[model samples]
Target: MNSLFLISSAIIIFAIAYVTYGAWLSKQWGVDPSRETPAHTMNDGVDYVPASAPVLLGHHFASIAGAGPIVGPIVAAIFGWIPVMLWIIIGGIFFGGVQDYGSLFASIRHDGKSIGQIIEVNIGKTGKRLFAIFAWLTLLLVVAAFVNIVANTFVSVPQAATASTLFILLAVFFGFAVYRRGVPLAIGSIIGVALLFACIWAGMKFPLVLSKNTWIILLLGYIFVASVTPVWILLQPRDYLNSYLLYAMIAGAVLGLLMYRPEIQLAAFSGFNVGGKYMFPMLFVTVACGAISGFHSLVGSGTSSKQIDKESDAKLIGYGGMLVECVLAVIALITAAYIGGDKLKELLSNGGPINVFSDGVGTFMTRIGIPLEVGKPFTALAISAFALTSLDTATRLARFIFQEFFEDKTKEKQSILVTNRYLSTAITVGLGGLLAVVGWQKVWPLFGSANQLLAALALLALGAWLANVGRNYKMIILPMIFMFIVTLTALVQLIIANIKTNNFILVLFGVLLFVLALVLIKQSYKVLSGSERKGMKA
Candidate 1:
């Protein structure tokens, strides 16, 4: 609950990791990224893009800074601030940062081929296909889980959905103008962004809330069209601009904490670790991004790689972005600490994560010069910004997974690229749509396991990558092993819980994920069983 203590802890731990562990890991697993940039290089400022290091950093941070920082800590704090704070700082800077930086350097040094491609390239073709299959299934869950998150955020603020819709429209115009016309991208970007804000303001003033059925249709339309659109306009720019919103929100939170030094209020603070039923099993899984996430590595390799300007940029984009997320987590901790236990339960049960966040952040801002009425809505808008960022990115990733699944290695015919991409979008969007409609009352419990399932998959992939890097395999082996054990333990608990609740759907889902984990472990081990890198040199 002490905002300063949380922030200081994160920074101090990050410093420790940077000096002792991060440096040692770099020495061990680090590879020269310069040589590989030539192959998958992009000369155009869009796909094969170049930007200043900071802008690229912003892109990476914005892409990764979704609802995780806000929701994870808030949910996990049921265990107590001490426990939540411990893992977030230690696990975040050490375990999470290493995974993210390693994944970035690995992918960048491999010419921006995805983690799946890196797994295959370094391991074997069969290994690569297996990784892709696991990734596909993981992406499906990502679409289902995150789309529901975005939908809920939007459902709370029906007017904000209009802002998202307008943002998409402007992206279409910007995409067409730059790609199909003679307009410079810089000029187009400015105009498009201005128009997007205009629409957001209009939406707020009018407060449009379409019927649930019509609302779902409109949202689906945006998903399919936006997912299929070229990345230059929407995906890249939306993420780029949204970073400002996210950062502003975080900055506001930090500034508010500084100006208004609120004491911690939870009775659970410094309490005994009486977890399990309260916050025991749920702690690590719910607070994913601030500590460790399997998803960031995917984004690091997949989309962020396309925009990186230079070799050393990996440090900025990966490591720096993660630090920013940790700070956001600290702010979230302050919110949890500020809102005591009883009110916290009321907030949780009432179903308004954004409002709780807004109330906390708004309190901080209110102490400063900002008015409460304005600051609260602005805080809510920031939540919407992150939610939308996650929504679009999840859609794109799911599309990538779907496309990768049907990627037949034929010379002349491109099956997945052309027809299969649309099919993939449909499948991905439909699954997300289904979740938005039916995935009710499923919060930290289900989503936590799902997110960790991703972390497990990522670690499994990391272990494979690290093994091929030869001398540095030990750097990742421990974390990978730890996450593997944790996943196995959590999987067991998940199955038992499902049985008790008589939720056959979740039981089946958890079992399927468990099998995927086992398969990935077996496949990764098969490749890493004293095998040499079989990649064709570009």
Candidate 2:
């Protein structure tokens, strides 16, 4: 029940996974440093720009480490610390890290294309289209969910809104300074951080409050611009700046844990039933990005793959990033457990998960002599930063999927309008905004199912790719099957719940996802079988 014991356990396991399993997978994938990476080979300066390992690592980690890790564990702690810890460590090491690394590996090898495109190469065009559509929908939920979450935080948690608004403005300033004015990253970052801290200070002193609907509209507008802008202009720079904040938050959580060393107060096992849902699938679905997330694959292939400077960096960025997120999830779990069940339930009554996280973390900070007024807003700022990074990143990735969906079949020259960035972004943001507005309650469960399902499909695609190339694929295949089964079970449970409640919208969505997953699995089997037969013939 000691927090230090749990924290140390997670660190040791994650370290082993990275040094052993991650390294072995890298070798099996044949990550050759001598070979040109997509970023270098296709350096276009806009989307495909070669970046240093540190910079790209920042972007990759920030994109993947969304509210999922923080909120998922907090909510799932209802089941107890043991189950959440077990899944975050075990699933993170074996399943999440593998999926993320495989995704980045496959995408880099395929000229920075997404896992959906990788599926097409290995599983055929139909598989690709189905996967792409599913990915797009998953991302739509991502955008909607995160947008709503961020907007709510801004409305209810005034300091969060202040910090986030400053963060976005600081991001644009940093981007412009570095890219346009030829300012060095070190200097620009220094100024940005200084200004950021000032904003944080100002936020605490003069918080901005708005209505939830108003915040939602403002967030949607920001998403539209952020999505449409070139990568260098906003997305990359913003994530990079935000990454520093994220790292500081992570470090702060560790420091607080070390200083306070609170005991885990929640039950080790909170029984099979918590909050009206069975713990089996709900736990898995709830504790998603903390353990594993399909969305990481999209971020990996969608943006990070295009910016990676070398193939050697993929493992570090992809696998290491997930491990770091796992660490954050563990921290979140600790914070939530220490907060006690009654306190958390009370916090949830007023605000969303951000309140739970901020309240928990703020309590820890208070133990270290920081006032709740300061600690609470600071933690809220961290949560808002996390969610907003995901919002823009999701919107941008959705844009990519939208364009990929309409790619010219004949390989002929396509019109600019057909492949226009703004147009694609408009469609992506528009759809996500609409969903966020109406489907707020309906999206989370469906999102969790779809998100994890995407991880399974990505793994299947990676396994198929590895098989065709004649490599050891057991590492990929086993995890693929496990996630597929877990996600399918989650989807089924969701379907039954929706039916009982007569939530036909979710029911329809669940059924569609089930069918898509079935088809993808069938195609994967065919691809693997065909590859085996070809090998025998040869």
Candidate 3:
């Protein structure tokens, strides 16, 4: 098994899927170009700013991709490359892509509301409330896990810390110049990307060193600001600019693999049970964002839908963005495979998957005449940048879910806690920060199960909405069913494991999520069965 061969095959498969299956979905879902998107009709200059396809793709991809595709694949490669590769390709195209695209389309059609609100429209107010609580809690797990990831990355790779900080300040300037001052997009992008590279270079020259705890606190503060501020100011431009780093990193890795053609040293199959973990649900849960994630639904519906300039962009930004992540996941998997199982375990025990990924890509870049010192840090910085992207994006999404839960549909006004973005963001960030201090390793498994479960519920919502609107929702049905089984099984295992370990907090969360998912599933079943369509608006 050669790395180049595997990646090439995956790329071809993804391209074909995007053209044939992705196009079929668009046509089936009735993507009308003439219809005005929410971004235009509900333009608020903050959350509802319309963006061109490319810029929106950058933001959507950056937010959803984050370290998910990287972290999930590398960690799940414990089951060997074959299973991970298969899931990334199959799940990305059919499962993740469909959910992401459907969620975006559903939200846009419903006036750019979050998935919770979508549930309210197609299901009922009760279903929406339950889903909102589940979604918000899941977002907290996301924020905690990613914040821990970023903080640890900064402490281990201080140069990335410097680059990430510089990236934020530069994004603010880029957002102001391109969005507010009316600078041309092309010229501004050129300058921004060039400056981005300069920041990386400067980071290597002068690194920023900080304690892990201190970095965590600073990161919490940063996300609080990021969640409350206008999207254009930090989220959009930072993600847009940060996307180029990922693009370059992927391009570099692929080009190096093409040149080097490294052999897949890891075994094809590592048994169903390795180290007391069964492959049944653990493998699926572990390869989450790489295959399919519920988190992507939140991002697509929560933020990307609001910024979409048109409905047609949903396919490219949603479906296409997911495939792009599949490509990255393939790359991450190769990094682990090329190192062999033994070295991978050693690296995992030492610095975790991100370091393994950076080192592998750094070695690859050497084939293209780039120094390992530079290439490794560049890769590290890119991953850290995206992790930070996920951190703040999760915070914002969490804030959205929190605020939406309190919104009174029958009333004309809302409370300050709900209306005040600052207060809401602070509360969300504060809670997530508490979880972050618990460490990512403790939280990742629960997060993975919760994330995949969230995907299941999102699919349920999409299926219900599609059925309500009289469209053929056959595409969403199988994926929805499969995810429920996988995530439910994983959650049960997690609960048992946590109880044995006396980790009551995680056990409590696991039980809560399992119950919420079951309740949502029951409600969606009613809607799908035509027994609960009394107030359905779709």
Candidate 4:
């Protein structure tokens, strides 16, 4: 099969999903443009400031589209291209898109609160607290995995590290230029872009090499500062800027696919077993962010919801953003397929998933006459940028959850310390840093399960919210059920795997996630089955 055929097919399917299915969903959910968004009503020139459609979409997409789409699809392609492609398209549209859109819509309706808070309104406070803890832990895993991954990249690929460091500093400058000095966004963006390319050039010329452990410590310090700082200072403007780089990378890869139109050399199906794990559940977990990540729900509800300018914009920023990510995942699967299975396994053994994607994308770029030297650093820079942006976002989100968890208690106790912004950020980053040290090997499997489980729980929260609003919620409910089952299977697998390997910490974490899922499921079932619906009635 020609790569162009697959690429074209994915493009057609995504368009149809956006136009027909996405529109139908928007209509079904009764998206009202005139409704006041929390961003506008709660504007504080900080976390709650309203943003234009494009800016919000860029930040949202950049936050959620991290390494997951690239890493997940390529890793799971071991099961075969057919399964991975089908999941990325079908699951992305029907599951991930709905979850993102629904979570954003629900959060907007609830004063830009997180899914945890939404659960409190629909279920109860205890349920919300439980969900909040789960969210915080999962986000911790995200921070740990991402920090280690970024640090490893910096250690192994010094030019990428140099480029990433430049990206961060320029992002801060961009933020200050636009928000503080009142520079026009267009001018600031142009300056930022120019500086970005210069950074790439400089990175190649004067690479900043560091050991992995040193990089990890420095990254943790950076996260602490980034998280505690106001959103406008670093998170939003930086993410918006990095988002453009990500968009360019995607566009270039798509063009390469069209220009090269290489034949698929990988097997279409690799039976029902891959790397000693059964295909049914492992594939779903492995291909998580590429298909239906729970992490996205956190981002959509936790951060993006606060910045949306209008209710209707949620559909575009949330649903549309996810479909674009699905396209990237498709491109990743194609990269693996073109590289062939044995070569991919070798790449995994030698350099890891990041190397696999960079090498594959670099190879494609080479096919189109771009030299490997240029393509390699460019691809690495893109991936590192993706991870770095996600790192701060996740750190910030974890801070939010910590503050939210302690808000009422602190108020009741008349204590300002627990909810202090700096304190919360410090605690969050500290825990994540600790886990990143010991949980390096354990984070991926555990993170995948926890993340998907979070998604299932988030869907249930959204489903409950939809029910409260008296909207047609079958769309929300079906995906909720599917994710619930898939996540449960993953948790069970991890529990068994961890126990056999004597990894008690991961085993405990897996069991805790399973229990939390059960609790959320019970709450959702009661609401959906009408038994608990009357109690939640407004």
Against the true structure, whose lDDT is highest? 3
- List candidate 1 segments past 4 Å from native: 9-27, 31-33, 36-52, 124-130, 169-203, 268-280, 410-420, 438-446, 526-538
Q: Go through the candidates in order and give each one's C-alpha lDDT.
A: 0.69, 0.84, 0.89, 0.85
* Candidate 1 structure quality by residue, lDDT tens digits, 1-538: 4666666666676666666765566657654545435224655443355554655675678778887878788877766787888878877776788778777777766666677777666655665676676565566556656566666556777767777666666656765676568577577656766776687687688666666566566667776776776666677666666666677777777777778878888755544345544354457777888788888888887767766666666776777678778878877877877777688778777765556677888889887788888777777776776766766676777676566556665656867554556787887788777766775345325556656666666665666666655555665666777777766677788889889989887788678777767776776776556654433332
Backbone clash numbers for all candidates listed: 2, 0, 1, 0
Q: What is the TM-score of each candidate against the true structure?
A: 0.87, 0.95, 0.97, 0.96
| Error of model 4, residue 218, in angstroms | 1.7
Q: How accurate is candidate 2 locally (lDDT)?
A: 0.84
Residue 495 of model 3: what lDDT? 92
TM-score of 2: 0.95
Candidates 1 and 3 compared by TM-score, better number: 3
In model 1, what are the clashing residue pairs, if there are any? 42-48, 276-280
Give the per-residue lDDT digits (tens) of candidate 2, residues 1-538.
7897888888888999899988998888888877888888888877888777877888898889978898899889888889999999988998999999989988998889998888887888898999888898888878888887888777777887887788777888888888889998788878887887887887778889889989889998998888777777778887888888788777776777778888878889988997687888789888999988999999999999998888899889999999999999998888778767677678878875767777777777766778888777787787688789888888888888888877866879775645798888887888888988995667566888888898898889888888777777888777888888888999898898889999998899899999999998987896676634224100
The lDDT of model 4 is 0.85
Ranking by TM-score: 3, 4, 2, 1
Which residue pairs come into collision in candidate 4?
none
